[model samples]
Target: MSTDEDLDRLIEILPKSIQHIIETHQYKQSLVEIVMDLGRRPEARFLTHPEYLSAKLISWQDLDYSTKRLSKFTDDNRAGIERTLHRISCIRNRQGLVIGLTCRVGRAMYGTINGIRDLLESGKSFLILGCPGVGKTTMVREIARVLANEMEKRVVIIDTSNEIAGDSDVPHFGIGRARRMQVSRTDLQHKVMIEAVENHMPEVIIIDEIGTELESSAAKTIAERGVQLIGTAHGNSLGSLVKNPVLSDLVGGVQHVIISDEEARRRGTQKSILERKGPPVFYSALELNDRFCWIVHEHVDRSVDMLLQGLEPRFQIRRFDPESRLSISLQKVDSSSTSSKGKAMKSNKNWRKNSRTPF
Candidate 1:
């Protein structure tokens, strides 16, 4: 029989359940293997009928555990099994497309894609946070691809561990048209960042796993120059990121962050900075709170630029202020706080309240 005939015969004889697995999961089993298994049963010879033969045997190594389990389902219960498989397949496909993954396994992956798109579209520096195995490196490479191909931006990747660029001794083929700077050590991260900016004239500089103090500082310098920066950090929550003085410094300026909860779960914790994007400002919540939270200003010392006293300031400090109004300067509490200062706002309840509204 032709291959198509074989497939049709198998689909017809098998219970609805097993057929469903084959259809949805794209399950393929070797005909020879099934024939061999059936040959062991002497009575199977009497069942020369193609329909009987197809129903009698099944084998596929590719199917996952659940799909494999469904293959053994009997005719009596096959309908219910098929329905279950069908539902899973639909949900998996839906999520895969939405999140940009081959299957549902790629949900976290798709988030990274969206995050990268955000960076390219918004032209902002960002961070991808995850301990490992949450597709951080893969996502970084894809970002490089999108930036280089679609946006036509000059992109450079600082591949430290070879994950982002792959291990071909040359830049991998998947990163689109970006340039690759393969570094054997992390010490070169800062130097590479600078070289990429000054020499390469890259519109976007991509790096993998920013860990050391030097690397962090270099990232800040690059961002300060107005060149877009993107990097990954190893941690679950934003708080953990702040713990590393250098990473905290580097991340302090990031405007948007995307996190992968799966990485946090794998590491027995619940945090990771999977993705970050910004215009070199707005790091974390506490950083934002300290720098620009709207609070009621019950008191203020005009002579000294400081909060006088009040029931916790109601108006948050704003990054900008009307030049004519009373000047309120908000300084970076730390290197991470975006330099959101003002000269026209002050410690006044009405002013603070009004400051929240962008003038």
Candidate 2:
């Protein structure tokens, strides 16, 4: 089915008044979220427009009409369409009464990351970093599908918020054959990561939101055991993550090292220097510039070292073409090709095309 048909399934849950208004959208496929706030006009949001879907202010009946068609809200005030990626987050008042809903449409946009297929196929653990809405979760899902269904690897997803997989017992078809391990609460992500390894015996463990020190330590444990790790961390760039003490372990935690005075002079640096303390839990990382582009650091240990030394790290610039075909450009530092880079992507051939995006 086309994306239009998928949009229909999501729109089906809205009240009749709002559904009539949404189906008229010229760019329904580009719709991002549908907003319905108590005592405010319902809206259908897209990439650029906040279009009013209904002229009338929403009432309790309107809200209930939509809620009745969906799953019950969880402790986190979130819900989703069964077996679909669309997410519905709730906004409650001080009394904990639902006041608004943000129904976010999720897509199984395949092939969006064809530009980074080489990185996915490399077999080393890699981390993706980007701001929200840049398709980190989307990319992770597609990679899980490729690894499990196509490459025949045993894969498991540590789905914390039900974003990686959909909100159902049956895993979304988008994930192919990969098994998913749902996290009951946010604080227990680290424990679940460990359990995924000890109990499941998966060849690859895909996780989302590596935010805490405990989670990063769990990631390190999994990587050390030679189980391939592919996940998203919270940082826009490698430099930001290194300074973030909680998440620094994903790129190999930083430490203060005391160098000999004589050695310091030889290196033309201060005696006290910061160095990566251990092998990075992730072999590489990619910084998403947008849905269509990313700046990649192919080597995690070397990238962290360069940042600690006050040297700008080189990057592999990747972009998707008008045809959704991926291309790679190497950004050289100091006019020398020998500078270190994020995954040194060689070419964009042999990327099997399926789905609408790499995400």
Candidate 3:
């Protein structure tokens, strides 16, 4: 999916001087994005390097040169090249004039779910969580493909921001035979999520970035209605997610219940305890610790219950073998206050940090 051809599509829209420097540079292979600000020299972001793409600062003419070639920016300040996975986002001034542009490189990367395909075959809903650039979008695209092409299931992708599919009227080939229902705007993503199920009659609904409480509740409804769901969200761990009031319901949520004095004494715990209010909306959750390693919770209900009880939950650590085979090891997660496992359980980072995302 990281093709020179697709990269060229985005490169074509850039000002000629900046584009020439990008194509001639050695960092072209590792390029992640191109930054063009009104008064700053154009910069190129790579996997391990951020360097200037051009010596001259970007001018109003250069900005207009790129903007005219791209599709009109939406309310979210996002525009994309037609039929390409690349994205162009604008930064506007106080008066609504474009001041900067973030040209993000989007690729239809495959093999993002090499270890999780079997879980998808189980027909249970799954929740994916990770920080930005953890390949969540890439994995969901591959999931839609596997469910549609190999298993022959009816799959619908509620593509908000056109992340899962390409930014075109038709979807990308990476989705295989799955149908895509594009949302008109980011705020209407939940409505499109519900609409895809009711109108299309899909066996599996593939969505990306379930951020808002309405979207989380909508996911619950879809799961309750017997549709297999696969999507990504913002939270890092089960404990952290259950603690977030906005996202807690995605994993059954939690509540403080005061137990009787006798029960508290018998249980050897405080009278006030946190307990799950209902069954988890999704039965399984996959947490990305980088791209190759994943921490998988097979049963969300059992795992959440264990976390609530100040106990460790069991998870399968799936890593790409050095010999190119699947290397799986069982790991237990201790959710008692201080925690450590991987990216999903990082104590230093804000695990419950919420971002306003549609996909």
Candidate 4:
């Protein structure tokens, strides 16, 4: 059976909340226990659902982080406090269903592995931009392994910090047959990319922390050569993502954008209390700027859009309009292109022509 199948079988034996934690996190039991204790909060049905359990863990971490920063906690208490907070964050990530535990950079997530597969099949590439600790290296390594071993695709991994391959010289990680090119601290990524393409002839190239102007340009150039590029960046969300000059250009050309649910939850908390309680809702594809990022499945797109739109303030229902919320039926969009802006109004017109958006 597949690794996913094995994970699913294990999930079947776990409690619903734990299953959610495990699936979101893909962790073993020992790790799950650490997360549960560090991040537990009281709510009647909160832990009943796995997704909510993960969210609760996130919320608790956020609360702890805020409290520690705002209050007069001692310098002596600082290390312990940070350790506690980090522990929670780590668990939250370990339990993350789509992306695994790591640091937060940009809006990137340890996306559902299947999502990466879809992007690869579409004749497009992916860049998983995030900060140092966001698990981009780990996630990308796993992705490379999955593509190479399972999907039978040739992959090259550019290990800048030795994080993806690890310190032992041999890849201590699970990524399969990934051609490793270690970038010395003084080396340039542009030069590394050139060498990988010229020598390895890989179907896809994976890199960690594409931070320079030259690295960004190289990624685009590699893509132009029909070599799929999957890498990471550091940012919080789609909005913050575009502001990053290096990542912005690479992401703009993406056909699909998969960010961590953790980032989504962070954005959700700002909206309303309800948003913080469940699965993260992706924004309308139209509002997104990435040209290659396509919502290929119309039904999934409609579902995500309807859910996200409801969570926004504009669609919120006040007491006066108990009936004010209109029910939105699922409708399919043929494209995920921003150039289709004029078509957006027309498409919405067609949507309204058929049904209303559910609030």
Candidate 5:
């Protein structure tokens, strides 16, 4: 089904007044989410800006009407429509009464992973880093479908919030044939991750929102067992992950080491320096700058080592043109350059131009 049809299902759950405005609004296609508060007028957030949906103040009656129609919110104050990706998060007052709702629209986008199709085929565990709402979940959903359906690999998803598949016993078709394991509580997600590998015997494991330290350690355990991992974490770049004490294990934990004076002088560096503790949980890492642009670090160990030394590392930038063609260019950051921007040095040796759209 098209995204428009999926959005229509989400629209049906809203109050009649807001639903009418959303159905007739000019920017309905680009709608990102709808916000409703107990005392304020309802607002519709779009890709560019937010607009008021109604003039009348929202009442408790309006909140009850929507809550009665949707599934029950979990311990995390989140709920979703069964068989659809749309997510509804609620805010409670001091008395534990629901006072607000944020209805976020979720669309199943195809052809978003064409730029990294080769990486999926390499069978190497990789981690994806990006800020919130940069389409990290959507990207991983498409990857699960492609790896399960096209590559014929056994893929299992560790769906913590039911965002990847949907809020239901049966998962949404966006995940293709990949099996999903739902976690009952947010704190128990790490245990479920380990359970999936111990019983399922899958070739690849897909995880979303890898935040806790226990989860990071579980990821390393899975990698050590020879299972290909496709996971996403919240960070702007590889440098940020290296500095994060909790998530640093995903790229290989960093530690301080002391070297002899003669060795430090030979390398022309300080006697004390930071170095990676051991092999990284993931072999490669990709930064999702946006939906269309991505920065790829083919080697996590090398990139972390370079960053620890205060030197710029080499990476690749992949982009999709308006025609849906994938183009890749290699860039190297010069450590000696005084300017803040890295010097651009393009490489055409491994450039790929695919004419066919995988979707």
Candidate 6:
């Protein structure tokens, strides 16, 4: 189904008053979410800004009206519309009552991964990093479709919150031929990740939100077993992942080693220095600054090593326009440049399109 039709289903579950406002809004197609809080005016959030849907404050009846029409909220205080990508997360009070709702609109954006099509064909694992709502899940969804349907690879998705495959017993068509294993509980996601590999014998494993240490360890185990992985974790960039103790394992992990005085002198570094513990689970990592802009670290181990050494690592900046035109350029980071937050990216536009392999 089209995104518009899927959006209509989400609107239908809203209270009548807010629904009318959204149905008549000019920019309804770009709606991001609808925020409904108890005793406050309901709001409709778009891509750019948010607008109040009604002046009337929300009441218990209004909240109940919407909740009753949707699926039961999970242990994570989240729920979704059946067979659609839309997600609804609730905010609870101290008494365990749902006081607010964040109705996030999820769309199946095709061609979202066109910029990185070549990397997908390489069959190497990828770890995508970005802030919330930067289209991480959406990118992985399209990746699953392309790999499973087009590349004919055995793909399995670890859908923890049903955000990737939608909240349904049967997986959504957005994922194409890829199979999905729904996680019964959020904490059990790591267990399910292992289960997907052991039971399904998939060639590619796509996971969303590898947040915990156990999940990170599970990802390492899967990668060591030779299965390709495509997953997302919470962080803005690879640097953040390296600094995050819990998720550092995803990028080979970081540890402090006490080297001998002679070795430290030869290396021109402190006696106690940080170094990569082992090989990275992922072969590449992409930082999604925006839906159209991404910083690609093609070699995860090398990039992590450079960061640990306090040196700037070279990377590629890929940008895609609305026309689906991809432009690739090399970005050289200067270690001495502190004005741009200790790093500066010099774009070299001499990159050729035909030089790279096609997916």
Q: Could you say which candidate leads in TM-score?
A: 6
Candidate 2 lDDT tens digits, 110-218: 7666777787788899999988777788889999998898889999999988887889988888888999998888889999999999999999999988888899999
lDDT of 5 by residue, 40-79 (tens): 9999999889989989999999999998888989999999
Which stretches in model 2 have alpha-carbon errors above 4 Å?
Answer: 332-359
How many Å off is the CA of 329 in candidate 3? Answer: 0.9
User: Candidate 3, overall lDDT?
Assistant: 0.82
TM-score of each prediction: 0.42, 0.88, 0.90, 0.43, 0.91, 0.92
Cα deviation of 205, candidate 3, in Å? 0.3
On the 0 to 100 scale, the lDDT of residue 166 in model 1 is 46
The Cα error of candidate 4 at residue 232, in Å, is: 1.0
State which candidate, 2 or 6, has the greater lDDT.
6
Residues 1-359, model 6: lDDT tens digits: 78889999999989988888898899998899999999999998888898998999999999999999899999999999999999999999999999999999999888778789888999999999999988899999999999999999999999999999999998889999999999989999999999999999999999999999999999999998999999999787887787677888899987767889998888666577677898999999999978778999999998888767667787999988778788989886664551232211111122112332111
TM-score: the better of candidates 3 and 4: 3
Estimate, for each residue in 1-359, the C-alpha lDDT of model 4 and write its tens digit: 23344234433423355555555653332232222234443221211122234444434444343333322222212111111112112322355321112221111123324433555665456545333443455567678777787778888888765556543355533566666786655246678887898888899888776777788778777877788777666653332343343444554421222346685475442211111122111121111112122122222233333333332111111121233332223333323432243223222423223332222
Backbone clash pairs for candidate 5 read none
C-alpha RMSD (angstroms) for model 6 = 7.3
Clashing pairs in 3: none
- What is the TM-score (0 to 1) of candidate 3? 0.90
Q: Could you tell me the TM-score of candidate 6?
A: 0.92
- Runs of candidate 3 with Cα error greater than 4 angstroms are 334-359
